[model samples]
Target: MSRIGKMPIAIPAGVEVKVVGPKVSVKGPLGKMDWPLEEGLGAVVENGQLLVNRLSEDRNVRALHGLARAELSNIVLGVSKGYERSLEITGVGYKVALQGRTMSFNVGYINPVLFQIPAGIEVKVDKQTLINVKGFDKRLVGQVAANLRAIKPPDVYKQKGVRFMGEVLRKKEGKTGK
Candidate 1:
């Protein structure tokens, strides 16, 4: 009865999907992703589309029905088009630069913070502030972006730090002038 679960995920060209028992593996040009089916949840490939069905009427099974389907669909999409997150660095003299496999951040520290970029993920810096994080796996892409953002969360007063593009910061007013 879940609206999302009722929808079928289409298999695009150059993408191969396999359903083995409770595990689903999708191989695409970008990469391969695998996930296990939840209890009472069943999925199959039919007519070039992935169909998700619930084998039981339990509430928990029903709840996971749609979520599992959506997550699998996301994986398909990720392998096809990939995922990307943009972050902006704001502050005086605050910047980021990439050196081969490592990223250097100049965020108010005497020494730049160095972070090694993970495999399958690409990090690009522009104008020393705008950062673009990209990868085929949505989960990994998002996690890397979050880790980069957490390195220097935005300040309330100056709003100076790393933040996702389009993210709003609640700026605090400066002290009243005497």
Candidate 2:
């Protein structure tokens, strides 16, 4: 038995979980999300908790057991409490602003870079340097933050660019003149 798959997911208040065939639907105060389970894996709710079970003991079936459980757990938690990712901008004039549904990144570029915000995800800017990406889907929230960070990943030499909040990077020293 898979350790993670054996663990039951606790359903918080105001959250509703439904298992329909291979699809799992989770709804809570934040939002609702639906996802299909992997083949040979099934889910059931009992005693206010959700459990993932495998139909067979094959190697592949065992592998998907934990994955299905984790995915379902993420969906439940996301809908109940939501998820957020924060990014910090470093370097002079490397700030961001939200214009309508787009993000304007001014990271020492001739023209500010632009990123369009997707539906179901919200972006909040604080004083132009800090950014908050929020949504009810953990994967989407993380993907959005990663895309924003890719705009100008941290510099190895100057350590300037967009990075996750509290991310530590070692600075590479420049070549010394002979």
Best candidate, TM-score:
2
lDDT of 2: 0.94
Count of backbone collisions within predicted model 2: 0
Question: What is candidate 1's local distance difference test score?
Answer: 0.93
lDDT per residue as tens, model 1, 64-143: 99899999999999998899999999999999999998999999978999989999999989999999999998889999
> Model 1: runs farther than 4 Å from truth?
none
TM-score (C-alpha, index-matched) for candidate 2: 0.98
Model 1 RMSD in angstroms? 1.3
Model 2: residues with Cα > 4 Å off, grouped in runs: none
Give TM per candidate: 0.94, 0.98
Screening candidate 1 with a backbone cut-off below 3 angstroms (N, C-alpha, C), the clashing residue pairs are none
